[model samples]
Target chain A: MSPAEHLADAGLVQLLTPAGERVDHPVYSPLAAHLDGDALRAMYRDMVLVRRFDNEATSLQRQGELGLWAQSLGQEGAQVGSGHALAPQDYVFPSYREHGVAQTRGVDLANLLRLFRGIDHGGWDPTAHNFHLYTLVIGSHTLHATGYAMGVQRDGLVGTGDPTRDTAVVTYFGDGATSQGDVNEALVFAAVNNAPLVLFCQNNQWAISEPTTRQARVPLADRGLGFGVPSVRVDGNDVIASYAVTAEALERARSGGGPTFIEAFTYRMGAHTTSDDPTRYRSAAEDEYWRQRDPIDRLRLHLEQTDELPAAFATDLEAEAVALGERIRSTVRSWGPPTPASMFDHVYASPNSVVDSERAWFESYESTFAPTQGGAR
Target chain B: MTTERITFAKAINSGLRRALEQDPKVLLMGEDIGALGGVFRVTDGLHKDFGPDRVVDTPLAESGIVGTAIGLALRGYRPVCEIQFDGFIFPAFDQITTQLAKMHYRSQGRLTLPVVIRVPFGGGIGAIEHHSESPEALFAHTPGLRVVSPSNPADAYAMIQQAIASPDPVLFFEPKVRYWDKADVDLETPAEPPHTDAAPTGLDRARVLREGTDVTLIAYGPSVAPALKAAATAAAEGTSVEVIDLRTISPLDTDTLVASVRKTGRCVVAHEAPVLYGTGAEIAARVTERCFFHLQAPVLRVGGFHVPYPVAKIEQDYLPNLDRILEAIDRTLTF
Candidate 1:
């Protein structure tokens, strides 16, 4: 089939309008046609809980309960849409800012919080969730995703044309990732192998103080064209568009269409984290402009217009979100400092002598701390 | 299980071949690894056997190799990565030390970097300056890493398996000069008794090659061979010398070392790398302080001079050969 045929097969990237109207598109129709009212409502709930969790994690960081947090306040639609697009067995390799995707993959919110809270790296088992650990490196995760996709091909997990038999890999990175040498090399490795992988680039406008233009000379999707991989640009703010696009791309991958690059065009409404100040690099006016195209609001508006969700339901979700936020707070406080030896424990699968000695020294040292946590001392 | 014997390099090839056969998660990535079977023919014929899918050839980007290997590792694949040379490993050093080393810890134990970085290290290749150098100390010093050095063919065969089977990121230092040094290697017989998965060099302990009462000669990798020979020579001199091979360097096996020193009352450390700020000195200081009363004299060291390794012709002069080792042994006896 032709490249355009593949593009058309990928679906045009939407099912709902920004003003909450259900829309129709010939090309993007196939992927989202499967998402009935229940699915959209499910997507909405996933986004709300993830957002609330994101907010609480940020507060925990500020309260010194966490080391830091990479919030996904504005990129919820992109992550949730892509997260839901993946099947139970399909694997996901997420960059650090994929809280929304983790939620969609059924990762426990408390487990993810432990990472930033300095309690644990990540508590979820990849086998249980089929969602890999959060990768802190920028574009490097793509190489791994592509390599694993190559493994998928060898295992005959792709090109079987059977939905149950096929497994696709989705890796998340951002515009800043485009600059990394490993990212480009991943493209080389993936294209040469034709690994069944999807490279999802969330072009959230600014990477730290640098704009998208600084990293990419053209659109991120256009960058994939030279590698013979099919590419697309989606409305990251529109949950329906993000879902339909990712789902189509993943389907193409599973069916042996090779790798696809999706540029989720969105904006970072909040500072990079609570640590960043948007006022320094970006204009408040630009922030306001992206806020108008808010992904969650548009999805909520579509739900309200369809009467698929009631005012009472929205109120209840808001209340539920608050309670979810409270749960996150308690989880943070209850996650007391990890056992000090745990610091050196997982560094090696088996205990190496150097690490053991270090652990022993630390154990003795920590014993010196009497009643630091409670007043029982 | 049927038992088979092979050379050090062949043993590595067999280990990788089995990983590909048993688990789909095992993959090999490195330069010239696919078509050329690696610069040393260590991975020779692997590409033909497993095809290019399992054995990968990539552009010469060290940082990209390690940084991306971290990703592949994340995708539930145990990636066995090869650094072509010790000097070239520096380019990817940051990723190894910072990202791969701390990733699991930073993730708070949520990540298991079951990735193996196969590096050829140690001097005495009789080649260029960069080609001949012992850089294991650099990686051994890093936290969240297991640094291993294999002295003989059997150790090489066993250690590679252990390093790959590990859930942590391991720096497998293959003494470049000793890669071709053949020994009786039983691939079916594991490092441990009865179990096939015995760690190649075992875990974080020192092994005594020979027992003596006059003094202790402690070393590892290329230096171990000469230290053993030196101990034999010292035997003729009536100074029975005990030689200890430090398999894992970072932890230093202080318990074994202190015990040996306490018995011998004298110690002589040897290595191919420069002695200053070298593994020998670190061992010396640690042993001296920990076993001060037990020591007969300040821990005497036999190592390469404090300078960059010399040209090929003079390279042998630079490496601590048997003569230099015996000279140090004589000095310890005089002390």
Candidate 2:
């Protein structure tokens, strides 16, 4: 078939409008049945919670509580919608920015916070929820997903034609990551092994101000063609579409159809990080253009138009959001600086003298420097 | 029990096999380790005996190998990951330093990273430049990790097992050229596995190979064997020397080192890495503090010249040999 003949194939879906209108695409019918009122409302609830938590964490950084915070501000729909579609057994390897996905995967929000707060490497356990810890380096996690899929295949968990029992791995990366050698190598490996993996690329159009054009000559989804892995592009701002496309691709993988690449066409609506100002690298006009694609606004508008959103329900949610924000502020205030002794605890499963000596030395040194509610460093 | 003479490569290979046999959760993951056996064939025939599931032949992605091994470890599997070469280990540095090293501490005592990362390290063969670098110092410096290197077959057989049984993440550096060197190994009836509880194995400490009186020769990983040979040569020149193999670099076993340094007031440190900030620098500072009155001379470090590892042809000049070690030994005694 010709290249244009294969656009938005199977579950390559698009739904909803930039201005709160409900428009269904021909390829997106299967996904519509899955998102009834309750499910659709739940997706919105998740988006709210994820955005709230992200704002809280970023605030924590500005308030001198966290060392850094990688905000998922405008990318909430991509993370939450795709995250909701995953089964309990499916493994997710998230890039550093997927705070929404971590929340959706049932990882403790507080635990995720501790990593950025400089209190831990990764406070939460990856195996507990099948959510692999956040990988900071771009494109590296794709190889992990490939390896894990290979393991799943070895376990006879693939090609059984069992939808419930069979599992697939999904690796999350960005457009910037597409340039990494490891990501390309991962595509080649996944293709050759026919591993049950999903390569999910959230093309937020900016890798800290290096635009999408810098990452790809053709589109990133098309790059998978060389490796023979089927690829898709979704309207990332549309939560329903993002979730539906991911679900279909995941279903295909679980059914032994091998790997698929999804390029979520979206825009990063916030600064690259709290340390960065987007106004420096790009034009104000570009930001305003993408701002029209704000994911939450369209979903809210669609609910309003369809009368699925109640007048009292919206007010109640707004009140709940305020409470959550206050609660987060309180949590931040109550949280004391991490104890220096906590550093020695995790170096090994058991104890080692090296850790002990360093701990002891630091304890004495910290005691001299700072006085806390309970003790010293 | 019977002692059978074997090459260091076979001893390690069998030891790995024996460890896997003992623990069902133990797995071997690396490139070419399965079908191609290792580059040096130290893990030959392992894939056939254990099946491909237990011995995974991974793609050439180092960070992913190390990072995912952390996940596997969290899932109750003991993953013995191999970074094919010392120089190639840079790709995995972020995962090793940020994730693997810190995972245990981050878990707040709730998790155990029983992951062992193996690297065939140090120089000898006239291979390309990347193949002949010693980068163990970087790993040793990282917190929440254990680092160990073995020079001889017995230590290789013993230490590798110890590292695997360790609860914390352990960076086990295998001397590549020493893989072919021979030693007597006890392949007899199995003994109970040594120390499996979550007790911190004072895992990093220097092992004194030969005791001498005049000056101390310190080395680790690949340099230990050459240091031992230098010790023997130093004996011929009437300068009695003690050869101490720093089996573990990160947790510089201060007690053993201080005791050894006190015995031999003159000290000469030898290693493949450059002298500055190498494992030797940490030793020299601590030893100087503890054995200030006992020292007869300032600690002398005989190591690779302060430059990138030289081209293969001229590496002999860059590498420290017995003659250079003897020169350091003579200089230390002169003070």
Candidate 3:
């Protein structure tokens, strides 16, 4: 019916209300209680810094530095919360806009800019951080995550009782992806195989110009039941609830409890990407409504009222954010286009005569051109 | 050397069994592959021997089969997936071309997906639509994949193991019509895995099945036998013919084809797919380019009609047969 009505649904799990008050749930509160003052401060800092990084990238896109950029402006809580809940053994397959999750995975934020700048399809070593390269194709990586979970099962790494040896997988997508065949197929595979996976969906309420209602008649979380997967809906703007639900899901997965579908109810506070203009399709009133429930602002309010926000901590975070922006601006400017011949590299792992001959011919053909002042043309 | 006469399907089964035995990470995934042993029984005994884990009977979704195989490959497993028929592969085309083919290139050499997609391809099965069709040209045109097909039982046994051992993604197209054809397989001679630096032989080279001085005829998979038969028929009519079996599709073995064409001064290509933009056209263009100066005539092509595969009763008229191959050979000789 109404936007507020959707948020206030009884099925929504809210550990912290929008008014910055810490509420409790019978099952999830105990799961989230482990976040001490230090963990809370770390998560707050993550959201702030991620927002700063996203804003800087948007500016770069406007300045013609990046080809395109996808903003995770309102998804910091859902990303950072679930990201922080992951164990080292867990693997993550993220869609294109997961800057907060990337930060939590220790990925160098500069690597993300390489993709947007059109220098490379992916920029990080997935094995190094247990975070896969961002998949631009909608809902495609869900199957990859499901298959990886199957591999974990085949490797005898599930239900081992030893937490260090056990493994789980998490794949992130938006509500619109629930309509995709691959996503639905991933659910089927994960359920039938009883694979260790968590299908984390951020219902940001918009898939570009379309709303979630266009994608499904029922709540997105209900689709999981049809596939035999247990599911939960969380107040995605509440970081504590997101973290608690993800942690419990990961624990169940590691212990061979099969797949869990988590629908994080959130909003898109910005355009879908740099090329998109949300103003044409949505209302300013709705935008303002979501701005008041901004993930970073809500956490800031809670920390301030509790007196956990020291003056020095705020100052340091602001300085860090400024430095990160400068670094992003400079790093992106320094990267030049890759070598012309490098395009033929890595097309195949084994020897390919066709590629080899073509590369040789191309090199000789280019050599025919006279050298420019800088180098060969 | 130890030798045994077996059907083409049995050879592939033996090859798959050997690959499973050679490496612990090698597994099979497809519909009806387990318990039912696949619709064609190519994987008949594997599920019973390796159990359900190694030989998996997946859900009836083609995209899911390939997409999940990618994930399994990412986790350090070699997954050989079977697409039930030639026509059924279109459903998994996105995963094959976009994701599976480009994974290594996109990852900048950081990832290698050693997954093999086995499809029973080509016509003359006298079956329904989509069951008999040659779609190897589509995969061969893609840069990141290695496309191959086997004509006889021996090559089927050896090439399947080679495809499994390869570090790159391979599209193994099996000629379904010849699945029951019997031939002697040398069981004792283990095929050496293909090497990157060396010239390819076992899986990637073109072999001269018959030699002649007048014309060179090139064919692969199910069409190889017909080409050889056509060559024999031409020989009886006082025409010397050379036959070449192109085992690998993507690389084309230009060196071998060009050398033969240069020597013969004439060439002809034959296959089951449509002649328009088919594998035969590529072979003709490459042969012409390299052997242009030495050629006495343009390279001719013999293949299926440029239309939908005809019904089962009159399918013979639509496919390339001995008479068609002989006619094409005559045209190249006369020209």
Candidate 4:
């Protein structure tokens, strides 16, 4: 069997099928049973908006407004599912491609574009929203998330049976990150410390060009078992299953059951970034296969089948997406370059004589540049 | 102040104990640090006194130790990580340089990582290859990292506490061979008083260990002992050699170095690491830039050759000994 076929046969916890049918999974059904019609519609709306923002960002990169963009084209279900599963007090550590998750956490979409525009290193205060700055280095933030979970444990924020006060951490990474030493080490630490953490691996089948087979011999979820973290596999295209599985894992973590590894088995429908050409490394047939299982389409179909989709709701959501796209495009174009001296502003929290002197020298050097012909200093 | 003689290892232990007492959030983590008291015993008895929660015996992984320390620091904990040896630090180099060093700047001052990474460095105890290497220059070269080394028990006690207190990440390189070396420490008075009317001696300034007139011998960590020894021998021969112990390597004590060089009109930099692209090179360049007209001679450097720190049998030849330091002192005098 092909890798995809083998994965499909591996008892994937799927609540929603590809043909827009809401199927029942014996294990994950009770987790999402409390989600009423409105809640289900909200999840669908989140996935649609996230996909729209991702596409707009990609267009911005193409038009030279951004340096690069990593599109969440096909994995919106996985991101929105897990993102919505989080409590307000729960913290999140994300890899660079978590723009979808950013939306769910109430992070301003324009802030996500700041890094790609070269205007800032990271554009948000993680503590303000319980969302950390996007980590570019693969698999590194898992350790940070695990450490934060350990902190939560120490602070008596876990297993208190208080749903509002108890906290759990969710860290997002891709299939490639699972092979990194830091990610594996994080699993070891989380398990040993019984840290309140959910290791969410969005298995998008490719780590850039290399397939998941290149990195892991068995299923990636199984690797967590060796580290003593209980593992589960879910159909990432099925939004309902993704939500149910992640919610279950996070609930388990907050109640002091230790770390849980949720492998969201999905596929990357776009190039790794705008800089990549998927045609060179992957087959067109594979793209076609995943395109049929688009996360947004599956949710929309499910809503339509249940007669819950109002004509005005779909029309209004489309208009909202259009307005969001325009706002992002205009803001990105109007953003100005950072001052040259600002680079040295936060190298250290306390004053360092060396940094102070260097900043002075940089100011003097920049003063030598003449004003442009436009007379805009 | 009440003073007592103690080994450098014990001084570090005492400093850690004091830091744990002073701050409830200060944590110590590393392999074998709890039960073994560290391979070099610099953290000896700390686990026993502070308990396992504060003094953590982490799984045998350097990347995990440093990476998680970054997390603890993020959650308002000051974690001091012990990298068992200088050479074993490479396993966690990516986390150190990319994460720990860049987090503060990337956060735009929203976060402050007060994590201290203590590494036992330098060679001379006749050990294995990986155990006896010097990599201070690598960390000092990185912009965000603050690198400091203490030669004797007093500075080890004082600087460890200072590094912990600072709102920045500091790479504290402990001279392993000198762990057993003894010095006077003031146990009665804290290294840093909580509310001091007087200006405390900052960690970045260099200290002039021995005063002289003809030449300045600038060194840090293990190299300071050799430079001091060379100065004493040179003084016996009527050649007054000044010795300066460089406490901090990154934000180098250039003012102290340049002033001494201007007064003496000659300078020599000594270190255990390779001279090529080492800390000595930067010091020599900075000194030349500052004391161009005051110098009677070019700044000379005494250090190991450009090769891996050799085996125990040939370490004496590879390391900057008293003789090699004296030779550099004599070379400076010739000009």
Candidate 5:
């Protein structure tokens, strides 16, 4: 199946077409109606900024500044759109590539590089942004998200009728994660417990080297239906559709409608990471196909044609994107290794005798060596 | 103080009840833990008193049970997760090791997951495969996790509460064989609140169950019983054996173990896990390293064979029984 076939699949909820036309769906179009021209422009700006950050990180990896990078190149629409749909109290459990999602939560993008730079495991405080630290292991955080939603249920934050008082949880993953036992188990748990969660799957065409077809015989959205979750497929490249679909799911969850699974049919425009090589596995024609359907460009075109794009807005966003790229480059270069003894910190929340004793022994052992010139020792 | 004689299983149940009563945040989750009271009836009656929300009968999925428990903990709820059995914990190993254990460190101490994973461990229950096994060492080897086991009803009652109250993730290994073992427990003494500024003690420390002089026989969980029996038998032959029950596996009570070994000058560590790279191997290595000068003999170990846990009919031949412990003790004493 080609990208065109998947995009035109029946039952796909899309509020905008690939050619920058504003289309409508009886269900999801109403959800996106609240987003005025300004809101849509903000979403576009977010996608542009996050894409710039991602590209800079990729360059950093190539320059040997970072160990690796997971680019959210083409999937920015799905991320920014859904991310903007989140309420302040709604927590997020993101897979490693949700940089755009992290930006939506107001997380400093520079701090995220600390992990790739090998200075820290996860540099940001999750509670500060109501966004969990990026979970690297595939499908692992899905259960955590379900569990968090279950926590929301127990806290009486669901079905409160008052929008401000209710909360929901959203977890992001790729097509590959659906095959993981944890993901399927999470679906079962969320369904049976009636957890207020949105299992957002970005079917970004490939999981590293393997294509989505290798992950599932049926549409990825259909996987959730078996678990009793209301599943939907959306054109992930359509920002308006992504936003609307996510908003609807979040509303359902907040109103105690239980878990919903949204499969965002998208494409990974870049290599899986700096460590991956798409040339060996996929065709250039396919890459070009997705690039032409670029999430940022499509939104930019729609905004321009609709007269929502003020001339200043485009120029200002371009300058902002350049500034973000520069900030990331400088911040990543300035990062240094953490203190040697700091490795022992936070292994346990409280004092542990083994850690304390080992640390003491290490300090004494290090003291045996004379200080080297220039503090090299 | 109110005291009562109860089985180790009932003691754990009572301790869980107290934790649930004291803190609404603490909830139980496991397969069959609710209506079925778990496969071993360890959690019997908790669902009735606490309701399904509090004592959740989770799907028959170990990883989901633990993974969600981590999420709940992240949300400020203290989740007491049950792993059903020792062998069953392997499915959730990735979540427990990578996520649950590392979340605090990953968050740079900004987050704490107060999750207690109750795993019924050890052999000699004469059950089917995967039902009886001791996988505590695997958890103990991982950083950011507290692995502890109770050999008696008193410790079982107190330790479960302590594990649940802890700010760090704890692998509470229940000795399945000793679940029926009866002992007096002080029910009134509240479990030391983990958030308090008191000195670190209790479940993280080892207890000198029996005091002696000639040799120190150290064990934990199911082995503690046979160790005491070995000590008593050795006492008849005039060799005073000091038996140490390692209530905590990880962050081992090196102070107590080394002190005992230094006094006795001979040591024998025992457990139901295979001796090869088992908890006993760690105890032996640590005891030898710390008490190098005080040692009168090389440290010995008594445990199951390197082979897989055998069938119930022939499990005795593979298990570390009182005779095997005594033999190791005699070897250490005579050496």
Candidate 6:
């Protein structure tokens, strides 16, 4: 069978159907008690704002404001559900395309644009929010997250049974990163060490132009079973399932249940990046199929059916999204280029004579150029 | 001051022991470092002394070893990773260059990765193809990593501790061939003492092993010992050859190099790597730029041939020896 067919047969843990109906599984139904009318509405609002930010970022890329943009259009439920499931002490290591995860972590939406605007490598203090900088290199951050989890173990933070104090680590990567050696190695280390880690694989079904079938023959979640990690597959469009599964996994880690692999089965509804043309590699039929299961619309529909979301609330949310878009547009346009000497500021923690000498030489060389020409470049 | 005669391998072991004892955060991780005590036995008895927790025997994955070590550093632990052999380090090259080397810079100084990667480097022993190779130039070319090698037992004992204590990530390249060579090491002396009245010899500066006026022989790691031997042989022939052991390869102690070259008017760089795009090329470029008119002859380099490190039987022809170094010194004097 094809990889997609295998995933379909694998019996994904889903709490909500794609047609805006609430469902239940024997293992996951207990988690539905935590999602009241207010909580469900909050989750819907979170998805709407995250989509707004992602859309604004994509538009900025097309309008020549950003160097590049990776949109999280269809994967909002996967990101937001898992993001909201974390404890405040839990650390997050993200792949480059996690704009929704960044939103849930309280990162200033405008600051994240600095990376794509070419003004900074990473703009926010990762330590401030317990969310690490985005790793562009695929699959590398999984190992880092595992190691940090090991550190958490060493610090006597795990197995404490304190909901407010025990720590766990969550790492996000796409289906494409599963093919990297670093990711496989990370699984080995995490299993052997029994580190308190959760491997959140957002299986968006396409790694650039290649389909998920090209990367794996079995279900992606089953790959974790070989490494001794417990595996589960969740319908990523069902935010209820994503949040419940991740929350249970994080609790398992804190209570010394070791690492768990959670494959959030989702799809990419847009181009991989602003530079990619998805139409060349994929069929419109497939895109239309995934569009019917749009994560944001499904959550909004569920809220409407429950009468938890009023018309006034939807109108206010639309206005809030427009205001957010305008703020990002103005902020991006006002950012100036960094000084040339700023490049040498953080190469080493301790002073390096070689870098210092090179910085001085560069400053002297730049001085030799005419002010107009130098400033223009 | 107390001194002891020990092999270079023992000196490194002693250094690691001191580092582990001094700082509770320091830990060791490698493929066979725990029970096997490393292939070269450089980490022998460390696991017994510190237990398996401190000296960890990791899976046979080089990238995982390095990538996880960076994470451990982020948690405020100083991780000292071992890459088994010189050629085997390629698997972990991406982690070392892209992540470990750039983490501090990418985080804008908020994250400091105090990671030390210990690699057994260079060729001289009659080992297999991958075992005997010099790839120091590849690491030295990367920014944010401090690459250092010790030529003698003293520097091996002292420099390893300094590399671990460094706030920045450091690549400590151990000369596998010189592991058995012996020298006097001050066992009680801390490399960088907190209460020292005198300035300690730093890891960045090059040291003048022997002073001469006719020519200067500059080398690091395994090549430094051969350069010193070649200088001695040249001295017996009435040619004064100065020898400088470059403890740090990346920073390129050009001050000491230029001062010696200015006095001697001649220079020769020696290493086990190929001359093309090797550390020698960087030294030559900087020497020419700094001391444009000081030399009576152009800077010469003695290094491995532009070919793969040959098999056991013909390995001598591939590596630079004392005779080849002296031949380059003779050629320099003729000018």
User: Taking the tens digit of each residue's C-alpha lDDT, what string does model 5 give over B19-44?
Assistant: 99999999999988988998878889
Candidates ranked, most accurate by DockQ first: 3, 5, 6, 4, 1, 2
Top DockQ prediction, candidate number: 3
TM-score of 6: 0.97
Supply candidate 1's per-residue lDDT for B68: 64
- The better-scoring model by TM-score among 1 and 5 is 5
lDDT accuracy of residue B151 in candidate 5: 90
TM-score of 5: 0.98
TM-score of chain A of 1: 0.91
What tens digits encode model 6's per-residue C-alpha lDDT throughout A102-212?
A: 888989988889999998898899999889999999999999998888888878889998888899999999999999999999999999988899999999999999988
| Tens-digit lDDT track of model 2 for B1-335 | 78889988888788799889989888998889998898988789999999877888877878767766765665467889888999999988987887677655655666677889999987878889799888888888888778888888877777778788878788988888788888887876453232333322334556778999888788887788789888888788787888888888866777778888899998888888887798888889988998999999999988887799889898878777777888888888778
Error of 6 at A284 (Å): 1.1
| Model 2 spans with C-alpha error above 4 angstroms | A1-12, A19-27, A55-68, A108-112, A115-125, A154-156, A159-164, A365-377, B107-112, B189-203
Candidate 6 clash pair list: none
Better of 1 and 3 by lDDT: 3
Q: Residue-wise lDDT of candidate 1 within A164-254, one digit each (tens)?
A: 8899999899989888876787777777777788999998877888887777666678888988889988878788888888888898899
Q: Candidate 3 lDDT, tens digit per residue, B1-335?
A: 98999999999999999999989999999999999999999999899999999999999888899999999999999999999999999988888888899999999999999999999998887899888888899999898999999899999998999999988999999999899999999876787675443534567788888999999999999999999999999999998899999999987788899999999999999999998999999998998889999999999998987898778888888788898999998898777
DockQ of 1: 0.43
As for candidate 5, its clashing pairs are: none
lDDT of 4: 0.89
Supply DockQ values for each candidate. Answer: 0.43, 0.43, 0.80, 0.61, 0.79, 0.63
Which CAPRI category fits model 2?
acceptable
Worst 10 residues of 6 chain A by lDDT: A368-377
> lDDT at A350 for candidate 1?
54
| Interface CA RMSD, all predictions | 3.5, 3.2, 1.0, 2.2, 1.4, 2.4
Error of 6 at A362 (Å): 0.8
Task: Tell me the tens digit of each residue's lDDT in model 5 across A38-97.
Answer: 999999999999999998999999999999988999999999999999999999999999
Residue A257 of model 4, lDDT score: 98
